[model samples]
Target: INCSFQNSVEFSQQVFVHTSGSPSFSSDELEIVEGSILGKHYKVEAFLGEGGFGIVAKCRDTTTNRAVAIKVNKSDPDILQQAHVEIFILEQLRRLDPDAANIVQWNGFFHDGERVCLKFELLDQCLWDYIRDRNKQGLPISEVRPILGQLTNALSHLSSVGIVHADLKPANIMVVNRHESPIKVKLIDFGLACPASAVMPGEFVGTVGYCAPEVMLGLPYNEASDMWSLGLVAVELATGVPLYPSENDYDYLKFIIETQGQPPDHVLDSGVYTEDYFIGD
Candidate 1:
């Protein structure tokens, strides 16, 4: 039986929609917490990055006195609700495989009256930044193998758990401890992720170039969609350039189709969708 409050919560969630809305960050009020909250303590340090859902910070946890990554959602109620949903989903993912070495570790989650904060393992550069930095310095391919392997392992594990990392761009894959012998690729940013069976076809839920063909066509997607994205990332790392940079969504879909050709017959026969939409590829 669906409780009235549960129904209200479900109704309140804004179903994922593809909007041309650019990302906006809250600049009105800044409440900086110098150290810890609840039982775990963290010294909120510097702003890492901001997104439509929240702002990530490089923080130092006082309890273990270890470096951490903190994502604090905007004060707006709508954004806060979205953060809750993200946390709820992530908590479930973490529970699914506590020892999923590829997945980023969730330290803890907290909320002050105004904002909800999520604490995660502090990692090194994102794949995009790492690639850019490498290109700038003319780094050798030998230095790139560990990063690539780690990411592949992460994606493989996520796929095994029936999770489709809808957004599998370089930006969402971070290299924790760049200097480590076998660098770890911690998959981050789940705001756009969804369970394989839960997401509907044609949701258009991913970044432009990294987005899959089905995403461009606004059709149902699955684990193969993520594999396509990872393949793109691997090619980009090999070539040092984005394979698909389309002008619009349609053009993007076309570009993917042109190069990769249409989805294989088996994929097309998945029965989740049957639209013959074509952009180019």
Candidate 2:
């Protein structure tokens, strides 16, 4: 479903891939509202959500007469730099079949004024919203099973391509269509994704409760960390409550130790940050 909009959505003067000229703007200046146009092609219909990166707008591709989600990056320097990194990670992911990989279909990128806009297929709702919509009751095992399968399949593809999805959580997972039978989901938000070889120990990433123990421990990690987050997400899907429900790494480790017992001495000793949690050497 990758549509080539090159003939349609023209790129603005600025592009994230090249040209690092300093750009400045206040949040108000980049605000997008209903009826606004992006890249002179996407007609803003409604806002899906917003984040530190910027905003995701549910826009109508006036050229193709189709719906799409356009994530526009903020003009802040650091945020813009991160957006460039995201594009780098996404470019590596482009080789995989979006459907088979169970990942979001990226429709390439374009410069929307000074913002880096990423185009993606329109999705129904995120797992967080979906769970909340069900009154926090969670979903049946039958539903959860398939959803988990798709996510693992996505992780598999990511691994094959040597990418680590540093951030995997309910909010980053989107359901294609809630009303559709045999619900399908795709992993979204790769802003934290990076090459496995580039992993640096002691660098913390991922959502609080969903973060893997290795990541929290400041140990070298890979796809295994993503698997850990997936396990938490699956539990949340089935119970309507976070399995860890911990606010900080300390509480997170405490809960894990309580239920699963502390990690073996060797594992704990290997973590760069392990000393922070230990009372005795």
Candidate 3:
């Protein structure tokens, strides 16, 4: 599930070794070399990126010759189930808003005997890289406004459809091109997304710096949690620094308290681990 790039030989070796215990695929069938053709259509070109539970590769669609991203999930049952859920949510979103400008375009998914691969439109660099390239000077208000607006619209669309993009940060947002005027962006990476109404109690989600206070406290949350993350993203974009640059949960909570003040009495009372950090108030 490590998303870091590995050469084809290394990746193939890892996949085979990982799949050895599973009876789902043979070693030969699961071997995914750079030039290997998948699903009888797409040809894997190179490693694009990786995630905690998936490996994404840049691919070429034989029929269209268009570049696309194929995310190959680990051959684990729970991971496979999560991939299915992500595809289902994407399909529903596509049905609801086929022309949603800010959302990443999901093509389809197919199993390659060893893993489920989900195809999506290939996008440019992520906002984090973009910000880093600029030495983290942050974007001008005029530039940040458009990016924020698009992201806001995307979030609103997800909210309307009852989806919560549990993970939303600069890395999850991709710009179409670095040199493009207005810097059009698309939201990507839905690995942690889920139904807003179905969020389980005490289930922690999202990246640390961008995660909402309610999520950190294991309190019940909804789409508003995404908004809270978005607010942090906005500040990061404007200042080129994380609003909460903490390394752990305690420091993160301390950062929140220092900037936004202490949680309300009711929030502290309702938190699952309030006493773990807070003594009285």
User: Which candidate's lDDT is highest?
Assistant: 2
Number of the candidate with higher TM-score, 1 or 2: 2
- Model 2 Cα shift for residue 34 (angstroms): 2.1
Model 1: ten consecutive residues of lowest lDDT = 1-10
Candidate 2 per-residue lDDT, tens place, 58-110, comes to 99999889999998997777776677677777878888999999999998888
Q: Please give each candidate's TM-score.
A: 0.78, 0.86, 0.85
CA deviation > 4 Å runs, candidate 3:
1-33, 98-101, 279-281
lDDT of each: 0.67, 0.83, 0.77
lDDT order, best first, reads: 2, 3, 1
Tell me the lDDT of candidate 1: 0.67
The sequence of per-residue lDDT tens digits that candidate 1 reaches over residues 1-281 is 11122222232223643332228665334455444342246677767777776567888777777878888777776666556556655755665453354777786577655677777878888878877876744335675676667777777777776777788888888877778865567788876666676777655678888777766654677888888888888778777778887556656766766776766766656533334453222
Clash number by candidate, in order = 12, 0, 2
Ranking by TM-score: 2, 3, 1
lDDT of 3 by residue, 1-281 (tens): 22321211011212211110112432233467798888888999987666556577899999999999998887877776567567656766775553464888887777787688888888889999989988999999988999999999999889888888888999899888888897888888887777776776466777778888888787898998999889999999999988888767788999889878999988889988778779854
Residue pairs with backbone overlap in model 2: none
Winner on TM-score (1 vs 3): 3
